[model samples]
Target: MESSSELADIKMVLAALMQGMNDTKGKAQVVEPKQEKPSAESEGVEGEEDVDIVQHETNAEEDKGDEGGLATYMKMHQDFYASLHYTRVQEMCKQKNIQYFRKDMGAWELARLDLQEYKDMLKGGKP
Candidate 1:
């Protein structure tokens, strides 16, 4: 037969083991609430349209040089033209509704007349 002290010690060990298991289970339950999966939109695939819009806006800036008078000037000046940075030139073009082009000159030649008049008027001549 086991001694009373030994039996008491065994009971104490078993009780501690049960308490440890319960603590682990409680911690697991607390952690479960924090492990949620991200929503589809947050993953980006569901927001493809937004991604496309952003891409289109970005591409529009690049394509602006392929459209209007500026494109013609750029073509004519392709070798000697002052290097106009894309953003600054793009802003000017946007504000003036000037078409940007890579090679076409018809519109730019016409626009040059206005610039010449402005310069002439600035110099005290009738535009």
Candidate 2:
């Protein structure tokens, strides 16, 4: 039961609303590129400066990721292998009558050694 004039007014309001929504959407898109978001996807490399910045960001992310337990485990494995004092452990094992198993050492071997004893061994403590 609406009049023709009322129908025209409704159409105009709807058109204005649609145009406003489009304008807001366009402005949002224009504003968004002011802050960059990093993605793991392939990036468009323009030149060295951009490339270095991207790489630095990526590396920072990697360092953050490396704070997880897997990184700790990996570091422990490396240290245990690299800095393990085998001869000291063997002598300490002998002194303490601990079981000795060579070539079957790693995580278990590191875990079995006491903290004090390990530190002592690191300091080249005599059995």
**How many steric overlaps are in each model, in order?**
5, 0
Q: What is candidate 2's local distance difference test score?
A: 0.58
1-127 per-residue lDDT for model 1 (tens digits):
5799899999999999897774654465444457768787569765454445354345676567655344554445433222555555555555666676642232343346455554566568544
TM-scores for every predicted model:
0.23, 0.26
Clashing pairs in 2: none
lDDT top scorer: 2
| Candidate 2 residue spans exceeding 4 A from truth | 1-51, 57-70, 92-98, 103-108, 111-127
lDDT of model 2 at residue 72? 60
**Model 2 residue 19 lDDT score:** 77
Model 2 Cα lDDT, one tens digit per residue, 47-124: 335334354334677777865344566556546643657776566556766677862353345444544455556468
lDDT of 1 at 8: 95
lDDT of 1 at 47: 46
